[model samples]
Target: MELPRHYNENRLVLMVQEPTIIFSYWELSRGQWESLGDERFLVLRLYTTGSNRVSTVLKEVSLPPFTNDWYFRNVLPEHTYHAELGYYGPEGEFYPLLRSNKVVTPRTRPVEGMVRFLKVKTVILDTTNKDTAEEQGDSNAFWGGYSSMDLVHRS
Candidate 1:
C-alpha cells in the first residue's frame, strides 16, 4: 500500500498552562516541510488581542529543526494571545504556515471573596442517621453547616 502524495497537515493549537505561560503545537505537511529546502528553520509569532486589531506581532521565537511544539513564559495574565507558526527564509522573510486559536490566561489574583468562595468545599453527610440529634433536627439540611435557627431566618 502507498500513502497519498499530499496530506492535510495544516493545524495549529495554543494552550494556556499558567497566567504567564503558554504552549503551542503545529503540524506541517510533507510538501510544506520540504519546500523550505535549506531554509527549514521555523518561527513562532505571538500577537496580543489589542494588537490584533492592527495585525501586529508582539514577539517572535526561532524554533529548532523538526520542532513542532513550544512553551512560552513571561506572558501577561488575563490577556488574550495568539500564535503563528511559519518558516524562516534566508532573505529575512517568514512564510506563515498556520495560525492558532486565541487563548486567554487566567488572572493572577482573584477579586476579594472570590478566592474564598472558590475554596469552599461542600460535603454531603448522611442525614438519614436517626442516632444523631443534628440529623433529627432537619432532614432537608443543606450541604453547608446550617443550623435550624439559620434556616428559619433565611426563610
Candidate 2:
C-alpha cells in the first residue's frame, strides 16, 4: 500500500523487528524539509506478533524537577491526552494497546540523547482473516494506520 501523502515527505520511519522496534529519525536538510511541506510532525511505525488487534493509546507526560538520572530511576504517572485509530477484530471486540518498555535512543549528533525516552508497543489484534495476513507479508507495503505516543517519562 502507498503511504499517505502526509507521510511521503522527509520523515522518520520506525520498523518493528523482533524484540525491539528500531526508529530511524531523518535529518532533513532545509531544502529537504521544505520540499516535503515542512510540517513539524513525528512518524511512528509499529509491528506486532500477529495475535490480537488492540486500540492505540496516546498519552502526554510531565516530569518533576529532577536530574536526568533521577528521572530515569523512578516511575512517573502519565496523563493520556489523545487516542485514535482503534482496532477491532472480526468479532468486533476492543483490545488494549500498551507501550513497550524498550525506548528509542536518538543517535543524530545535534539531537543525540535529546529525546528523553521512547516507548514502542506491539499492537495485538484478535482476528483470523487470511487477507490481513497477506497484506502484512508484503514488506514493501506501508500501513496507513498508526499509533501515536507523544511523550515518555519514567513510568
Task: Name the top TM-score candidate.
Answer: 1
lDDT of 2 at 144: 45
Tell me the deviation in Å of residue 142 in model 2.
45
Q: On residues 1-155, what C-alpha lDDT tens digit does candidate 1 reach at each position?
A: 99864455878899999999999888887777677677467789998886446556778998877677888889889888998988666687888888999998999885653122122333345656464434456544444455555656789
Instruction: Please write out the lDDT profile of model 2 over residues 1-155, one tens digit for every residue.
Output: 98542443333233223222232232334464454353323222232221244433332222122211111211112211111111234475533222233233323235334443333333333365435433556453334432233333312
Provide backbone clash counts, one per model: 0, 7
What's the lDDT of the predicted structure labeled candidate 2? Answer: 0.30
Show where candidate 1 strays beyond 4 Å: 1-8, 113-155
- Consecutive 10-residue window with the lowest summed lDDT within model 2: 67-76
Can you give the lDDT of residue 145 in candidate 1?
59
CA shift of 151, model 2, Å: 47
Clashing pairs in 2: 52-124, 52-125, 52-126, 53-124, 53-125, 53-126, 76-155
**Model 2: how far is 70 from its true place, Å?**
21
